[model samples]
Target: MLRFIMQFVIILATLAAGNALSSVFHLPIPGSILGMFLLLLGLLTGVVKLRWVEGVANSHLRHMTLLFIPPVVGLLLNWGAVHIQLWKVLLVLSLSSLCILLGTGYSVELYEKRKRRRNG
Candidate 1:
């Protein structure tokens, strides 16, 4: 449909602009991450309406696991290198995961407490 194409075009253009900016500025951040930040800015500023991309975005979220396929495959292919550092890799992953989980849980609890106070 025309709407679908238009939505994709807008999202892709934002990503392209972010990539261009990152390359031009020589930023260390990956272009894809920059593009996501750009997209978030656009959404917040009303430059990119949520309605325009909501459908496609939701669809992507629904099949989000597909996005990890390439990275997972690459890791598998390079498993020999990873195998040597498996313990170190797992330790780092475990610690990071624990930190993230704790951080998120505390953040949510804080938000809920504030919300309750505000409402009452």
Candidate 2:
């Protein structure tokens, strides 16, 4: 319980920092993207050790799919708006999926190449 609370506090603080930075720069991207980037930077820099919030963070990430529930529901409610842009939406979906697939494949190939180089 305490760990969960701490994790929540950390996430909230990161989000606040991200929002402040975005406002200062007048970024066109969403504050949430900025927050995620800040969190990734913290993780990479060891400023925020994974062990500090590992369990709670893992639990939250495990249930991250639930976060999309509200957005999906809102989309359903606003189906008419989407219907007008169905072709555009489909095009975006196709391109995004293709990008994700290509990125994953490239990352895997890179990882394998690096491993082989290190081992051999």
Candidate 3:
């Protein structure tokens, strides 16, 4: 219990610090993203030992699905607004997914070609 509390506090503190920087600098990017970068930097630099945070992090991961409840609820509630234009939304989603799939495939092919050149 003590370890869980400490790890949770450490994660929240990092998030708060990131939010503070975002507010102070008026950066266009969101604060949570900043906090992620901060956490990554700390981990990479060995300033934050993974053991210190792993407990709480694992707990959050275990219950990650619960996090989507609010957004899913919102979408259901707003179904009427979206239902009118559902066809348009489906078209956009389909086209974008195809584009993304093709782009990812091309990227992987290029990466493999470069890797082969380097290795051989």
Candidate 4:
């Protein structure tokens, strides 16, 4: 319980700091994204150890679907908006999924071939 609360506070503080920095610099990107980038940098630099908040963050992230349920339900309540963009959305989704699948498959194949060459 304490861990969860601490994680939530840390996330909020990071976001607030990111927002402050963005406002100070007049950056065009969103505060949350900037915060995420900052968090990533901190992790890479060992300034923020993964074990420090990994458990809490992972737990929250694992149940992130629950957080989206209300928004999804609200969207369903306004089904007309979805209908208007259905075709365009579907086309984009299909194309993006195809690209991801192809890229992942090619990457795995390349990795396997390289591994085999190294071993042989």
Model 1: CA > 4 A from native: 81-83, 99-120
Native-structure RMSD, model 3: 1.9
Say which prediction, candidate 3 or candidate 4, comes out ahead on TM-score: 3
List, residue by residue over 26-94, the lDDT tens digit for candidate 2. Answer: 999878789989989999999999877677778888999999999999989998786466688899999
TM-score sort, best first:
3, 4, 1, 2
The global Cα lDDT (0 to 1) of model 3 is 0.93
Off by over 4 Å in 4: 81-85, 103-120
* TM-score, every prediction: 0.69, 0.65, 0.87, 0.70
> What ranking of all candidate models by lDDT puts the best one first?
3, 2, 1, 4
By lDDT, is 1 or 2 better? 2
| Runs of candidate 3 exceeding 4 Å displacement | 81-84, 114-119
lDDT of 1 by residue, 46-87 (tens): 988899988877776899999899999998999877646668
Clashes of 2: 0
**Top lDDT hit:** 3
Steric clash pairs (candidate 3): none
lDDT of each: 0.88, 0.89, 0.93, 0.87
Poorest stretch of ten by lDDT in candidate 1:
79-88
lDDT per residue (tens digit) for residues 5-117 in model 3: 99999999999989999999999878888998999999999999999998899889999999999999998999877645778889999999999999999999999999999
Best by TM-score: 3
Q: What RMSD value applies to candidate 2?
A: 4.4
Please say which candidate is ahead in lDDT: 3 or 4. Answer: 3
